[model samples]
Target: MTLSVTRTARGMVQPSGQTPTGTLHLSFIDRLPVLRCNARTLHVFRHGHEPAEIIREALSKALVPYYPLAGRLKESSQGELQIACTGEGLWFVQASADCSMDAVNYFDNIPMVHHEKLLPDLLTEVDDLDPLVLMQVTQFTCGGFVMGLIFCHSICDGLGAAQFLSAVGELARGLHHPSVAPVWCREALATTAPQVYATGKANPPPPLPFLPDYQLKHATMDITPDQINQLKHEFQESTGQTCSTFEIVAARMWSRRTKAINLEKDAKVTLVIFANARQLLHPPLPKGFYGNCFFPVTITVSSEKVSQASHAEVVKLIQESKSMLPIEFTKWINGNSVGDVDPFAPPLAYTTMFISEWGRLGFNQVDYGWGPPVHMIPIQGSSIIPVAIVGTPPKPKKGIRLMTWSVSGPHLQNFLEQMLNLT
Candidate 1:
């Protein structure tokens, strides 16, 4: 088969040996990179014949700007680049097929769930599991394809990674330059010698609090359009409040979870809201400032209160929590004004973490030559069931997608049933 290769900018492809040129952004240098983990699915379409050459060309060109990271695969001398931080991060693999590409195109169009139980098994196989990044491409028996990506948690937040993927997509589509340049602002993090100071003086800090231990169970629940409307009506009826899908689902799950854990009345059952701080910060971050750009805003209700609260009340509590996420609070956190805690420590807040990225903020606009991904799901981590709320596409009538980690099977089932009842 004759291959057609298109090279737009000669200099864009930096040779393998060169260091990243251009002035290193200072803030990016100062702060440790925040890790963001997620995945994207792609569907490849061929017109009559598979454009293998064109696809390869697009991938190569798109990956050029990210060449530094891609090229690091070739570099063994740089120990930092080669070393894996916690034996639990990214990995790359491939899947192959024997049939024609067209025969498999239909299968590529849909979304597939990565089974939860398979995670530990998957993790064990990858060397240096933590800090491991993966890019797995599967080729079906026909010409169809699937791509899976896994990122670490300490490098970039979800938004940051989305920004990076957008760039790659633009490049793959033959854009000479990315619409938004990547930003690096790690230096902006406060420069206190010690992360925390005791009584206004520097002192060795006490051991950080340990995160609660819990196993996650995953299940898929469906809600009908009528059911969704009913749930919305019931929510307003119960608490004189209108709630987003996230609020309703999150509230039900949180309540049931606390009940199952048997948390005490006096103990705080905190629902952490991962609020994006990008726009809130003074001199808002540039489009490229992809590090950890979100902070936790929490609502700590007594377990008893939570158990007794109506769905509306929970929604309101979630809404009120947003008020605590002012940019100043983040500034305080980065400045060490608040109690200093080790960045590497296990989660300090009460165990639960909720993250939402439902509205695609141009995240799906990433159009490598193939087209934007149909779905994206986060594989849950060990201790926490980080809930990622995603917006459903046009065809899938599902109200919303809840990607959760480490939730109990029975509790999750109960929460879904309750949600359906409310609906």
Candidate 2:
């Protein structure tokens, strides 16, 4: 189905109170090289109760506490990225589509091509002085609407973005105050860089663009409570060690995808885990610190090891990745300066997997008086590396739903079969 815009408007969501006049230093995790632009997403509501007026009004109030969101991305004399607290405001757009909610499967299964229409255009809406956040409320003929948002990664991670939206939902429901107050303590997570002794400094490497004419195949698979528990039981029986829900799921994926691709046995495979650092900070961030407080923990091993290894073996590697907290947390925080080479970059090889955990983010809990959202869809920005988004089960089941977007390849069928048979 084709989507058309019925009306469009920009809402100047300003801070409810005066905001400090200065640049907000972006923490090391916030300045990741790959996350330099706005990360787009789609929120679908089946029974259209969210009106443009309500959303805009609630957003204005929500911006009061998260004022930095209304600021623009700018660079300091040292060439470091920071949020210039100008109170410029966020961009709000309203659009309408010709299809019904059922026509698009209620967004439970999305076609890669239609995603472009459901999201705001970054090429035109984003600029150096433009607001760091842009939102579009797209309405459907059947009264359903999609809330599309573009959030600058330099300002916050996915968890931080959810914190802001939760506030908006509360305000829309006529709440006097947000459940969690927004906190800004970017400098608290800073770490001292260890001294480096080298013969000479080499010129920085250049950025790599996405693959040429890449095709993206998107799929959503659901795991049952019984299946989850069974997998955990099997792993514990084999290794005599228990694993978290995330560990079991990630291990299975690593094993299946690697075999499906049939890569060389000696090929190196890296599992990049995006870990949260809110509590890992020495003194801990405020209750609702809404900034980039997560870092990537990458574990690399030969393809033969991961593909042929049991789920328990893979889980052990993932646990090793998470164990880098506290001890490694200090070195990671202090080692990199503002302009230093990005601590990490997107994997240049097809053998790597990037896993993101969204189960605990509470995307479904965000209610704007219309009840909770039925589905949350992450718009893919790049297609070179395989990316997976793990979401909680629909009900209070012990399992989760994993959505993956990967470059179209021959191994898709094998990968899909293995994922479906995990039970």
Best by lDDT: 2
Candidate 1 ranges beyond 4 A from true positions: 1-94, 97-133, 190-213, 223-243, 259-262, 331-336, 340-353, 358-363, 383-395, 409-413
Writing each residue's lDDT as its tens digit, candidate 2 over 154-180 gives: 787888889889999999999988999
Across 107-220, the per-residue lDDT of candidate 1 in tens digits comes to 322224332211211435434323223444444444444445554433456676667667756665677777777655655543443433111211223554565555555544
Residue 141 displacement (Å), model 1:
3.5
**Residue 281 displacement in candidate 1 (angstroms):** 1.6
> How well does model 2 score by local distance difference test?
0.74
**TM-score of structure candidate 2:** 0.88
- TM-score, prediction 1: 0.68
- Candidate 2 residue pairs in clash (backbone atoms < 3 Å): 191-333, 191-334, 192-334, 193-334
Worst lDDT run of 10 residues, candidate 1, spans 3-12
